[model samples]
Target: MSSAIAQLLDGKALSQRIQTHLIQQIQQLEPQKGRPPGLAVLMVGDNPASAAYVRNKERACTNVGIASFGKHFPTKTTQAELEQTIQALNEDDRVDGILVQLPLPPHLDAVALLNQIHPDKDADGLHPVNMGRLLRGEPGLRSCTPAGVMWMLQEYGINPKGKHAVVVGRSILVGKPQSLMLLEANATVTIAHSQTADLAAITRTADILIPAVGRPGLITADMVKPGAAVIDVGMNRVTEPDGKSRLVGDVDYDSVQAIAGYLTPVPGGVGPMTVAMLLKNTIESYERRI
Candidate 1:
């Protein structure tokens, strides 16, 4: 496989362009709404990773001219307390989007809290209402990461129609929604997971392969089809022999790059696109509220 056979999907560049367009849209819409679109990101615990993600989202909201109503809570915060906060934000006219950062403390019921967010303001698109809408192929806010993957595919002119798409994860956040999106685009979709038998066998059948399972390098070059479009949504942090940590995706990038026709790099890939879609969802909710 020659290097010329592969091309980077470049989600970071596309995400910046998305932010610019969002900024212009916000500026034009602010006068009529009397306020810029606002997004509330509720994060619990001192998990450094979740804190970093919240900060990135807030910064992106600021750059896109959207207001942030973010909140940070202690890991020991009660479920009822968090529920009350969500209810207040749901009714707050100033806020257009609401998101709960994932992997909440073990004591909390993440699904119950996510269910409480109003469907229209469900920015993360995990609420049962939003998920139902997605299942029905209705017009509603989409899951940020999966939506970003679809947006990237469109931007790169890689249509899923008539192609075979294998999504290797079953989480509501990325894999399930990702497979649904590909099906909506007329692709034949198959979903495999970490527990699936002969995972590599299914992977080789895909024209489009998206893996969101957290394990690093789960998708090796031998598992992929030549010229397949590989969009990696997994993010894992590992310590190197030098005692330094770095981020990596599910796909074995260095080897797979030589075979895939289109691929997204780990740090600059789906990560940035997820934040961009969060801003886009906020703006969409803002327009509908008016």
Candidate 2:
């Protein structure tokens, strides 16, 4: 085995490159479009983490010349109210994308509200229509996190064709879509979840391993194959022994880096890519209008 540290999949730099390109594209199209592309991010409650994420998204929109039509609702906001707002945004001619921030109030039904978003404007790509389109390999908006992972792979020339790709997690949000994308790229995909027996055995067999189960330190060094590409999609905040909090991914970065040929860092890896893909989806929706 080659004694070299795994190459980092630097998502932050790539995300910036994409945003810069998008800025130029928007500048060129604004004249004919008459207005900047608009994205409506509807956020509910005061969840600190969600608030921070919303702020980051809106800031990214501003940087890329996209108009932010964001709305902040109180914790007690009812489901009916949010649904009405989504309907209005759907009808709004200026808005090209609409995303409802997740982990909504306990009383609100997130799935029902997501279903109400018009398929074309579903920027998060969680609507059943988009998911269905993905399953059929048809052209449609895709879930941002999974799409970002695919882009990262392609950027580094890591083709999945004819490889054994093991994805740990079966959530509709990331795992399912990610597996489908890999399959589309001609990889033999295996999805392992919480109930999968001998998880390490399955993971060690992967040429490309992706863990999106949102648990920290779940994939240890022994679980990864030597020289295999490891992608960490999990984002978990854990407190260190020194009483400091930090973000970590599913794979043990230090250990995996030594074993795998390529690995993505937690905060700088999949997180930035996720936001970048969201912006890309919104831009695509805007272009479709023209």
Candidate 3:
């Protein structure tokens, strides 16, 4: 095969297109419904990264005419207080979607707080009910990142059916649900984690490779099949020799791009799609209410 740089999946462009469409849909519905769709994002502490992410989500909501019911809590916020807040949002008719920012304060029980959200308002789709629906291939809100990956594949006409897909990382947030989605698309799926031995051997056999582990340079060029589609879901910030930090993915993009047939860029790939999917989920919940 002639070697060439891999084609980009271009999640950023696709996300923008999806958002534009969503804006029109919401506008047409808001006139009759009397209020725009609403999303409640609850964040705790002052993690710089989490703060930046919350801001992005809220900004996206504003851009699409969705109401933002964002609540920011101090680092010392208690689990009981957060639970009560979720209970309140659950009862609020104005709120259609509720999301609790991850990496909450140590004293707070994140899972318990998430469980308190009504399944219909679980905007992040991390609630157990939604996950179960995904496993059974039923209609329900889906986990945002995994759903975004599936949408990207469909947008590019990358059919996973009858292909071997190897997913690195088994976290519930991305890896596990991603594997399930791939399976639903008829791809033969293999999940590799820290305990898995001979990781490169498994990856090399894949027609589609997804590396979600947040380690820089984990998947080298040699580990990829020459013509495989490589989706890099890992987002890591590493300092350069000059002490300046920059974002990178799990795959070594420079080397892998030459070997792989298709590849996703670090910052512009899955990140924007995740946000786009979040907005989509919120609007879906809103539609259910009306």
Pairs with backbone N, CA or C atoms under 3 Å apart (clashes), candidate 2:
none
| Model 3, runs deviating above 4 Å | none
Q: What is the per-residue lDDT of model 3 for residues 187-290, given as tens digits with 9 covering 90 to 100?
A: 99999999999999999999999999999999999899998999999999999999999999999999999999899998999999999999999999999899
Residue-wise C-alpha lDDT for candidate 2, range 1-290, written one tens digit per residue:
55789999999999999999999989888898999999999999999889989999999999999999999999999988998999999999999999999888899999999999999999999999999999999999999999999999999989999999999999988999999999999999999999999999999999999999989999999999999999999999899999999999999998889899999998999899999999999999999998
Q: How far is each candidate from the true structure, as Cα RMSD in Å?
A: 0.9, 0.9, 0.9
Q: Which segments of candidate 1 are over 4 A away from where they belong?
A: 3-5
Q: What is the lDDT of candidate 2?
A: 0.95
Report lDDT (CA) for all predictions.
0.93, 0.95, 0.94
Cα lDDT of model 3 overall? 0.94
Give me the displacement of residue 151 in model 1, in angstroms.
0.3
lDDT of 1 by residue, 261-285 (tens): 9999999999999999999999999
Q: What's each prediction's TM-score?
A: 0.98, 0.98, 0.98
